[model samples]
Target: MKLARAIHFDESDMRVYASPARTGEWCISGGFEFSNWTEGDLTGKPRQAFANGWLGLETFGRATFVAVTALEPAELEALTDLLAEHFVTYYGAPSAEAARPVAQEEIGQMVELCEDHAPNTLLTVARELTESGVREAYRVIESSDAGLDQFAIHGSLDDEPHHH
Candidate 1:
């Protein structure tokens, strides 16, 4: 399988590319490195929303992705509203709750718990936690392909986790 990569700087900027996959579709994937967590830097941008310690949407195909950072509750609420708008626009009204930014600390605890498990296993656990609006808000967008699936979430990893 071929993978396409894209990076967004801050909240206002976004860039996407098509990969060698047969569908020629753009996939969304990203990770948060929360070495620096500050309120001013995160809330300065109009489109930016901080959850734990990272900024920007970790999205794919203009649909599903994660937003992890250390944002205030008000900021997270605003970001969730924005994500809902996007979800309605792209995915035809989310059957699930709209995406919301999650705190970096919550993500840290989850990762620590999964330290001994495989990466995919950890992802499954995290997905379960974010499903149906317990606390962390996440949306899973279905891909065009019949056999392939993509996932996105918002959180910070002390280090960049390798993607297989």
Candidate 2:
């Protein structure tokens, strides 16, 4: 099966996200985090996350990019359990048992989304609060169409107090 994993190209995510997802962790849309948010909440780091962030399953944190990858059944089940626990602990779900199905549904949506894309393809999400509610859109960049440079900056810079 196919799924997505968080990938970081730079330290920008650390600065922009209140909680940044660890690189190489599994990820999903995670839009549920913003369900209760209002226009007034859309400022600063939270705004950056709403603009573009993938919810990392392990850390329950935000990621800027996620690349398509393979998924094993065991891993899926574990992710579901983690999410269910999160719902109970954070979202006030009655119990883990009661939250299981909803967690499965959320992960299932991501699985369905990745099913059609090739492995290693990069995915990005953009969300906005509209008159009615939140609106989400996705952008896909196939591996063949993009390279590492597009996502990250390499090399180093030295500050020798050079004068120009």
After superposition, the stretches of candidate 1 with alpha carbons farther than 4 Å from their true spots are: 1-55, 58-69, 94-164
Summarize candidate 1's per-residue lDDT along 1-164 as a digit string, tens digits: 11122222223233221111112222222222212333334344211222311222234222122222123456434434554554456545653253333232333343333344322221111111123321333322232221122322222232354454
User: Per-residue error at 120 for model 1, in Å?
Assistant: 23
Report the CA-based lDDT of candidate 2 relative to the real structure.
0.87
Question: What is the C-alpha local distance difference test score of each model?
Answer: 0.28, 0.87
Q: Could you tell me every candidate's TM-score relative to the true structure?
A: 0.24, 0.89
Give the poorly placed runs of model 2, Cα more than 4 Å off: 148-164
Q: Which residue pairs overlap in candidate 2's backbone?
A: none
The sequence of per-residue lDDT tens digits that candidate 2 reaches over residues 66-89 is: 888889999999999999999999
